[model samples]
Target: MALTSIIAIYALFWVMSAFVLLPFGIKTHDEAGLPKVPGQADSAPANFRPGRVLIRATIIAVVLTTLWVLNYTYGWIGVDAINIFEKPEHLKR
Candidate 1:
């Protein structure tokens, strides 16, 4: 539960949030009835608003980081919950 750890976690969440939310509010040139530049990529967005993406990513990262911090604090979901390769204690015998 160190400050650096929290900051790192937040940064990781922020990047993930940004990437996952990137395509959500976007539209291709064709989708938006906009003309494309010469040789532009087919998937380019007509409206690429970095500011909107930034805001949404920030909010998602905050919520996710908070939940992660809470989980770290309370041990609500432990490593064993998702460790599929190893046999649990009761089954080890």
Candidate 2:
């Protein structure tokens, strides 16, 4: 794959990882024994750490992207393997 394609794919994976990891490790004010400020939403996290979240998301994305790249390079699973409707020539006999 091209360099740009790899970068684009990685970026997509990073964004997806961020969203998937957002709710994890979160603590609402009530859960953390912190008093909520007036007008604060009930679901809002008491301690939001952007840096930590970003780091975790990056790690997750890297692992996923590495596996994806390896699969692409080695063809561990190919298009034919996923084509459920089509039978291989040998199997069609």
lDDT of each: 0.95, 0.90
* Residue 93 lDDT in candidate 1: 89
lDDT of 1 at 21: 92
User: What's the C-alpha lDDT at position 43 in model 1?
Assistant: 95
**Model 1 lDDT tens row, 1-93:** 999999999999999999999889789999999999999999988999999999999999999999999999999999889989998899988
Where does model 1 exceed 4 Å of error? Answer: 86-93
Model 1's lDDT to the true fold? 0.95
lDDT computed for candidate 2: 0.90
Candidate 2 lDDT by residue in tens digits, 1-93: 788878888899999999988888889999999998999899999888989989998998889888888899999999888998988789998
Instruction: Give per-candidate clash totals.
Output: 0, 0
Error of 2 at 32 (Å): 0.8
Clash total of candidate 2: 0
Model 1 superposed RMSD (Cα): 2.2
